[model samples]
Target: MSQEQRLEEQMLSQEAERRLSEQLDGAEKIDVDVQTDLLKIFQGQADGVSVTGQGLVMRGIRVQDIKLQTDSVAVNPLSAIFGQVELNHPINSTARIVLTETDINHALTSDFVRSKMQNFELNVEGEIVCLQPQEIQIHLLANGKIGFTGKVLLKEKGNARPVSFTAQVCPRTKHKPIMLENFNCTQGEGISLEVVVALMQKVKQLVNLPYFEFDDVVLRVKNMEVQKGTVTLLVDAHVRQIPASASNS
Candidate 1:
């Protein structure tokens, strides 16, 4: 080949490589943004009392430290604009209930009562356990006795009825908070429970974060268990894409 022709070909190849590099960089940025948004949503949704005082605390898997491959992005067109992502880290979290006598009474009388059951009332004290990653177990004292009572009553001193439940997390909206769907107690013939939405809303309002929403991404609980007085959950979250305009804002 002529010298001039060889030089021209080299320049064209370099230009193509530069354009590809820029595209890859842009895709990575989008991936990071999506992951960051998901973490924010998780933190926001996690702000609530499962029992009282100490609620949920999400840890590990820093957003900035998350890494994504360019090839993963290339496979999905939406990922090119938003970023293809996967979270394989152990999600560590804690939920503890430490309340004063007054606080405990208020929680029992107001929050624990259901509108349908007027006669249903009881005092409870205990620690949450998360030794297993599939469910949250609770060993509490009912009326100072070891037991838990609800639609089904199981009571015994120092041998309280153990309550356990699993979580099903999902995204309810774009760039919003996630929801724990069908949280059912799997002990004493099993019973489904619902989180107090009003309380959650109040907690969110108190935080007053501007860009927070509800259920921005979907999550599947891979492992969950309780140890001592804390419940820990390991989850895999699926972060969906947010519109470019909305994300920018």
Candidate 2:
């Protein structure tokens, strides 16, 4: 390649790295390590990128020690080698994501629900039920309730009972508070275990937290599954690229 071509390739690579670094700025409790090379720029290919990371702490939910691994990811050579980088094309990749039950519990109790129920004594737990192609089932328990007189009520001794709900994780949306859908629970005679309005409000607020934003990218959960006490999410994200002039500025 001519010196002019080499210089342009270096500029493209540097621009890509800068954009990625800006996207990950201020990420909480998550550490991402990514390596990229432009050795094949002259060949019109980007096949020298690898990513691996561990201990990604989810903000609203108390999930810690999340791990992500991806092998060498190939990209459109012409786009990356040139000044215009279009990531719209799908790149076949092998990846693995892992999360533990303890992380789920932490996420549930960390910010939204747990903080909202500070007036009442609350104990929450989550259990992964199944892992399949694109579905996840989780059983959640809230062991106490707030009384009418503004007092917290604990579970009774002989008849200890708790409010429990079964939720399924599905595709996420920008307007949705969480991936949990079709929430259902059991009820006894003359008793109704309905979700209160306050709880719903808190949930909405939780989903609007700052941690959910990904710079100019829109990220949504495409699928999720549970396996061996862990839940893994397949996320789909779209990045809004900055204009060339703005980036240059």
Candidate 3:
């Protein structure tokens, strides 16, 4: 790589690192061994999710803005002889978002609940984000991570909410294919991209961000002590073409 390209790459890497640090610095950790109480899952995160129609509309619930980590990869053939190409390798791109307590903290709990001597844990019958077509699932895994598939919804049954998210948790790009974009904090030539939407489309949000990502996510919060809900995810993408001269100078 040329010195200038090296410098640019370094800057991008630096920004990525800085963003990761900031995220970790501000993160409120949830212990994997400790199961948390129940909390509400918002249904309105659909806003800004797409430039299409307003997301699902419900009676008593609204989709809260959700934090997400997304990833997208593109595979292209360097050269095609005839109708056949040799091989295509995968190029992975990622993105992320951090939501505050006020953002997606529909779940709530307090230190007082943890203080319960005998009753160490209580299953909080968290409120469901009642709505028309729940877009996602309220997933409570065994590792204490609160999560949902692309089909965001709230069907928590005190024990665990049944997410509305289906196998097609990931949404697809309506206008342009998400697989054709490359993204960086700084604007450049990569194809048209939206990290957040791509994540929701792939139904693979949070797959890119490992720090906040839960392996076998679970709920550890107590019912009455619930104060905040922890939702972690990452988003990433790769563009079809970068204006070579603009980005690669």
Candidate 4:
């Protein structure tokens, strides 16, 4: 590459990193690699893009580490001149996310996640029951199983009762429904079989969604692994647009 070409690459890399940082709440470190040349920029194409980050927080959820790669991207040449990545068409990307045990526990307690868990309703024996998670902890185990211990308040007919349970979650293939196994009540009043069955069905439905869509992005899990102290997930994302600001906004 010529001197001018190298300089252009470096400038694009820095701008990519800055834009990625703007999309997150915070990060310990972020690196961006842009594979392109002046010729490709003039043609409104990028050879590829790779990003790596650690301790990244997005939308109040903290990730331990993440690596993302995109195939050739199509952009507007005008946007490139202003250091903006305006996609001309949807792009396909692969992402790997690593979450440590601590990250999981902290996310469970975060106000953003907790707010989503509060007052969750379930149908048990034709009665509308509200489930509010009070405390939850996750343990990554061997054999693709995750163990959880949590206390929840189950409100039925305006009366609330605390129920604590220990359970194991096992995910099958990407196409199969997640299995909730060995759910045992550890404290407080035990949950009934009917409620347990209902909860499991609810979990299966959520985990088996066709795709998770948000903010002009659609994500589908390609694979997942659970091991001691860590959980890792591989995802395929279809990006319609890149956010230029933090998720909270």
Candidate 3's C-alpha runs over 4 A off are 1-91, 105-227, 234-249
Per-residue lDDT of model 3, residues 81-120, tens digit only: 1111111332223333233333332322222222221111
TM-score of each: 0.22, 0.36, 0.19, 0.86
C-alpha positional error of residue 175 in candidate 1 after TM-score superposition, expressed in Å:
32
State the local distance difference test value for candidate 2: 0.40
Per-residue lDDT tens digits of candidate 4, residues 1-249?
898877777877887788779877899989998788888888899888898999999777889999999999897888776676667888899999899988889888778777666567898888998877788888988777888888888787888888887888785456665577777766656567888777767655654676777678898877778888888888898988766644335
lDDT per residue (tens digit) for residues 20-88 in model 1: 233331222221111122332223221111111122111211111122111111012233223222122
- Would you give me the overall lDDT of model 4? 0.80
Against the true structure, candidate 1 reaches a TM-score of 0.22
lDDT of 2 by residue, 50-152 (tens): 3344554334543333443333444455766555545434343333455566566455445444544433222222311111111112332222111111112
| Top candidate, metric TM-score | 4
- Steric collisions counted per model: 21, 4, 55, 0
Q: Work out candidate 4's RMSD over C-alphas.
A: 2.9
> Model 1: residues >4 Å from true position, as ranges?
1-214, 242-248
Candidate 3 TM-score to native: 0.19
TM-score-better candidate, 2 vs 3: 2
Best by lDDT: 4
